[model samples]
Target: MVTLEQVKHQCRIDHNDEDTLLLGYVAAARDHVQRYLDRTIYDVAVPSEDPDGVLDNASIDQATLMLVGHWYAHRESVSETSMNEVPMGVTSLLAPYRHIGI
Candidate 1:
């Protein structure tokens, strides 16, 4: 998905204190997006990794970043701010990559 630096840049953080935490969020976000699309997204980190069932596209990457930003901002399940629109955007980004029943 996204790198820790990318996540930090997205979240506008200027510190390295939370690199591990941010990396964790990145992994979780990547997995979540992959699951939502019902397929594996390509992993650039592992160049030797299998390419089968993998999607290497910008939308999926952006969606993953969006999710990480959202999760990073809102750590808790519940928040005072309404987040009903975030998922819609993520879905739209992942829609093309999403597998539908035939």
Candidate 2:
């Protein structure tokens, strides 16, 4: 996986700096959403008769947007300033889902 900083570096000399970085971040965040859902729903919710249906209603894309919205909304509230903060936010956002256990 490519780091956000590395992507930003690649896009630094481009004409659209902020947009490029933002797009990369969005893609990375959405990928995180997919991986998180896959892990929490399939791998973690094991031994169940119907795990797929359990997560069928999950909308990773929408959830990713919400996560990004919340990040921008409360950027100041999050004490951590590093890139790890995004994944940390993702974990917190998905905490409620983890307890579902299919």
Q: Top model by TM-score, which number?
A: 1
Clashing pairs in 2: none
lDDT at residue 96 of model 1 (Cα atoms): 74
Over the stretch 1-102, how does candidate 1's per-residue lDDT look in tens digits? Answer: 567778898899999998898899988988888788777676554244543356567787788788888888889999886556855588998887776657
In lDDT terms, which candidate is top? 1
Error of 1 at 30 (Å): 0.7
lDDT of 2 by residue, 11-46 (tens): 342345465546655666666765665543332344
lDDT of each: 0.77, 0.50
- Predicted structure 1, TM vs. truth: 0.82
Compute each candidate's TM-score over C-alphas: 0.82, 0.36
Q: What is the C-alpha RMSD of each candidate to the true structure, in Å?
A: 3.4, 9.6
- Name the regions of candidate 1 deviating beyond 4 angstroms: 44-52, 86-88
